[model samples]
Target: MSVEAKNLTFSYEKETVLRDLSIRVPEGEITVFIGANGCGKSTLLRTMARLIQPEKGAVLLSGKSISELKTKEIAKQLSILPQGPTAPEGLTVEQLVKQGRYPHQSWLKQWSPEDETMVENAMEAAAVTSFRNTPVDDLSGGQRQRAWIAMTLAQGADTLLLDEPTTYLDMAHQIDVLDLLHELNEQEGSTIVMVLHDINLACRYADHLVAMQGKSVFAQGRPEDIVTNDMVKQVFHMNCHIAADPIFDTPMVIPYGKGRKPYGAIAAAEAE
Candidate 1:
């Protein structure tokens, strides 16, 4: 489940999004990628998942080139849930999740006991079992998102790559999804690589942090090692107060020095 990227580079037209970026994702842990809006985090993730082929360098899964593996073989070993997976209207959750079993199925070897077990387990892992019969379009945003994750889980892959998994979610639902992914990593020993926009949340949940600057890796290590206030200012171009979460005991970031009120604003509020 370990992933290594060596000299990984990707380009769009004449522009290079990733430049000689390389990092190792440890097996059976959550590795979070954090960067500014156009800093190539998504590009790197797509390349790592083999969704978009890199113009230069290689993404190796367990030291084997991803391109060398058969499509099905690669799928069985790693599954990716790209940002905002779109499903057809009227597709039920069960029907959608069942699609993840495709790698294990063939025209001949279709729908075995193992397939059934995997689908069931995926639903349970994503906590979408109750809504299995609901149409995907009818489900709430978070529920629909979970259904997509269920599909990826049903692939029965050891490594799961998610691009901005918490996109378009409210804070409550964001934590909910993170909690589910945390459970997956702990219980199933799945190696997870994800792009996360929230630095605080990423630091809290990620076992390892990969910070990116434009077209290159800025820094990567345990969250505590790399998520200092100075690092935040350097990577994000903003000032922040860094602290430890009282509840989760993880790095907490509080952005500051934006839109400061006039003098006596605080006392004026109490006087009113």
Candidate 2:
């Protein structure tokens, strides 16, 4: 299954955030959206997830307009994790994860063995099984983020949309979360779309990169092909050197700014 945004135009009040944007999300791959702040990356993700309605055009899920589908039906096929999600004060990790099964449940089937299995598997996948009984409020930031991701995984949707899933996370925790998502994509063949602020991480992790600028896609392709020093300068308004990551062998962006000195230069100066 694939998700496509066709000629999408979205606005807040009188100001337009995204205009005439069109892109197709490749199925069974990790796609990352990158841009500077307020470039409408998050807004575009939200629009595709149906969290926000578009002022013009439509989001199509497998050739069908998402607006035409029932809410529960859409939930069964697509799951979304918005930025900075908050749970109720006293909700436990298990309780929150169990909520993901709501779309598959009805009056005739409130709870079932299938629901229990899904929740258990989801917690295991997210590495939050040990904290199942703990209240979400009691968990650390990383733990809580994993708990939330477990809930999204429990939904068993083919397409997953995330907005800044690594916001406020330490470097290690950010990698942990992203590694979990990468595992899910590889194991389950799920389509993953996320808005990310860290361009280097995006380039390292994304199978397909969508770089937005001026409220539209500036470029879209494999990170190796799309990420360039000129593209970085144009999109981010900052000078950067585009190099290959020694580890991932993908495009790496080294930004330039005051007080930012290259390690090799510093070492050379010290030697002199």
Residue ranges of candidate 1 with Cα displaced over 4 Å: 258-272
* Predicted candidate 1 versus true structure: per-residue lDDT over 1-272, tens digit per residue: 67899998888988989999999998889999998898999998888878889988999988899988889999999899998888898899999999999988888898999888989999988999998999999988788889999999999899999999899999988998899999999998889999999998999899999999868998999998888867887889886666689988899986764465324543364346
For each candidate, the alpha-carbon lDDT, in order, equals 0.89, 0.92
Worst 10 residues of 1 by lDDT: 261-270
Model 2, 105-187: lDDT tens digits are 99998899999999999999999999899999999888998999899999989999999999999999999899999999999
| Candidate 2, superposed: residue stretches over 4 Å from native | 258-272
Q: List the residue pairs that clash in candidate 1.
A: none
Worst 10 residues of 2 by lDDT: 262-271
